[model samples]
Target: MMLKRVAVIGAGAAGLCAAKHVLSRLNRFAPPVRVGTYANGRPIHSSMYRDLRTNLPKEVMMFPDFPFDSRLNSFLPHHEVQRYLESYCQSHAIRPHIRFNTAVDSVRPVEGEEKTTTWQMTSSDSSGRQKTETFDAVFAKCHSSLSLSPSLSLSLSIGEVLHSHSYRYAEPYAGQTVVVLGAKASGLDISIELVKVGAKVTLSHRLPRITYPLPAGIQQSSPVVAVEDDGRLRFQDGSVSAADLGLEIQDHVMTPLYHFLTPPAFPSLFFIGICKMVCPFPNFNVQVQFCLAVLDGSVALPSRGQMEEEVRRELQEKLARGVEHRHLHMMQLEQWDYCDALARLGGFTPLPPVIRSLYEEVWRQRGVHPQKYRDLNYQLVSDARWEALN
Candidate 1:
């Protein structure tokens, strides 16, 4: 059996690659399949901030077959990434297949007498016209939401409260006493950006104190525990403060997924770009390949029950090892093994030594000087070495 039609939700890096790869392998299908991409906006609703530069260099951030322009900086600003995605769509003829400004409302599986299932997708366009379409398969690359602590609730009378999702520019927060929760990438980057713009920034996280140098006016503190009745903030370490502005920088966790890709109960649907703390773009490349393999029967997955059990065991191990429930999908140092497993199962080349070396070097630089890391430039000299340019 061959897939006759596929729907790719979101036109971001992952969705674009999914569509491109599907189109590339049209000859493999008995009959060529039609692919459609849906996006709620202009296809650039990435969680990118105005001044944000990529943590990983462009060398490793690119798909294996496509390279970013060598003339561009190693660490590119957010807008450059958006432009690259736009260019990717145009170059691969993906834009014509996309329904921009259309939001997918629901996706439900229609069971059939045979084992195969079809998906009914309900979506609305910018004009509020609703439409329903059926597809042979679906790739959901939709954005997830940031999880905030349950105890902290803010009233309208409280000062500005913003999730990192709504964060765009630091100019709007120039003179406020900002308390940023979560010391992860966005939290740290936004705090530094705010401090540069004269905001008195207090970074609060449950993790151990960060060793990287932070600019003056940016201080670290314990995580916020609660919001008092009098509008005061309570901290984990029994500290209290009056916060004028709050920024939640915690990473967004994708809803529980099987193997971080498939929903256990629904094998026809797949998710990409859900794993965190890894080289994102390259990881997405391999994930999309694996999904295609599953669809084309090139890779055989276990029975539904077995796959669900495997996902449960993986999550249990992470939880037993003290990993947060929400962070079950985080690969971190385990990304290499995870990527290799995907490539092995999906019949793709593993990441090269150059990508690994560059990835590690950037990580080390980030640890040593989080604020100054992006200021340095790097070039991959070979498969095993990267040189930092002065």
Candidate 2:
């Protein structure tokens, strides 16, 4: 049997893991090909910021098969993580298979004999050279965009409105009063950075009032709902903030996925790392292994109708548990069980129990000391155990 021709798009964390696993199983797979749009002078989609350090410790964030350098800090800067990914790529000899500076334009499924899918993908390099390729299996990223109300969309007319996605460094806005929106990870990190740079920050959010001791220069306020007629900011509680400029943090895409792994109708196409509130690297590890099993016929998939029914039933169960529709994909506590189920179904070794235990400990610490949890460190030892250090 000829090895399957597989195409993996987006050479990020998940893509790299998929490629690594594909290369290891030579009998059932060809050399995997990857296409990514993230290079210098190319379209930027990465969330890395210049001065950002990971909120989670490296012990909890690293891939199970590959560990970070033993000498580096537990909470590493963005560049360190990038370097680690580069090292992983080199260690696995995955660089030669990637198409650098290439962007995927479209992926259309061509049905073949017996209802099998052959993916026809079109891509263009930075130099505008286009190429079309057909592959036996395709792994890609899912794209979604959030819909802003007209009033909020018009708020962009205000003098300076910068989304955190575009924010790389905090120096340019020093000494300026900035209104940061959203109180989640990026929002909180950005707020703290601005305050350290002599910038006055008004943190606006929809969540309950933060009880933690925030930095002195930061002030908390209600979520920003709209812009005033004069271009000032209006909050959800009818309050307004007057500031020199503004900074907002928001996700570009929001859509409901039928299943976290792959669509029932498109078993040959897998979307990885789309779930929110996940331990990313380990999550990618489990997902790619499961997808590989699906591709090589080790794990038999259900019929299309049955898959669709399972999806509906899963969503209904989540709703019955009082989970909001918007949070259907937020699998914070559910990820462990999900990983276990996938491992059992695919006949792969499950993630070590130490990872989940350490992750849960970090979550508890984050609740008690949101801003200081990073000061803690951990060392993973043999026998699925981790030791906490000061």
Candidate 3:
């Protein structure tokens, strides 16, 4: 059987990585497959901010086969990571497969009696030109929606509101009181950045107040309860703050995934980079290889019923253990095990020990000093070793 074509959605790190892997291993499959990528923006619309730097160091953040420039800092700015991705695509000959400024409309299964089914994708470019194409499989690497709790919904006229998605810099909110919702990484980072530029920032979340020492202009608040008609922000603990702007850090919730890959009902469709708190580039590398293995008949999946049942069981176990549904896919300390499982299942090499050690060290550093962690430097000495260069 010939697996003639594959479609990858999004042009970000995950999509580019998938395209590179598919193109490189075309000879492994019975028949060579052609891959194409669809991106919604011209230069790529990633959720990167102007002052953002990667929390994970470049040592473990790179694809296993393609290392970042050795002279680059361990913690690189967002543009450097973007440039690394561009370089990866160019080096792997993936540029020819990319279709920029094209947004995917829908992907659905083409139903038939065959055991292995095909997929149909509809996409439209900026010019409003639409095209429908069919392929043996589809990989969706697009960004998911931010999970906003229902209690925090406010009227449109309340005040200036924005998701972290639209946040660029801190100068715009200088001298104004800003309430940032969701105290995740972005929430903490943005709050710190805002305070550096004179924004009175309040970081609010449902979780326990963080014990870290914040900058002078920044304060911690209880989770936001409601927005009053007078533009005051009410907190769960009955505190109120005069709000001029609101920024919501997008939270990701697992969407009933099977092994964090595909929905059992649609085996031909897959998603990458949905898991949180993992080394993204390395994770994408393993996931793409495993997905390709499944496609080329190298790995056999269980029946649809079995796959769906397993997903339910996993979610139930997590909920029983006090894990929220929204955090089901968060692989903070579990990332190493998860990556090893994918490698074992796909017949690929497991994550190197050096990567795991560096990842754990960085995780500890972030907790110890969230504000100053990135000041540390690192060097990779071998597959199983790394050194902290202070």
Residues 280-320 of candidate 2: C-alpha lDDT, one tens digit per residue:
89988998899989989999988888888888888889889
lDDT of 3 by residue, 248-282 (tens): 87566655577798888887688988888788889
Model 1 spans with C-alpha error above 4 angstroms: 28-45, 142-151, 252-256
**Model 3 quality (TM-score):** 0.93
**Model 2, runs deviating above 4 Å:** 37-42, 142-151, 154-157, 251-258
lDDT of 2 at 333: 89
Model 1, TM vs. native: 0.92
TM-score of candidate 2 to 2 decimals: 0.92
- State each model's CA lDDT, in order: 0.79, 0.81, 0.80
- Of 1 and 2, the candidate ahead on lDDT is 2
List clashing residue pairs in candidate 3.
none
* Model 1, span 129-191: residue lDDT tens: 999988878887744333444336765455888877778889988988888988888888899
Which residue pairs come into collision in candidate 2? 144-253
The local distance difference test score of model 3 is 0.80
**Better lDDT candidate (1, 3):** 3
* TM per candidate: 0.92, 0.92, 0.93
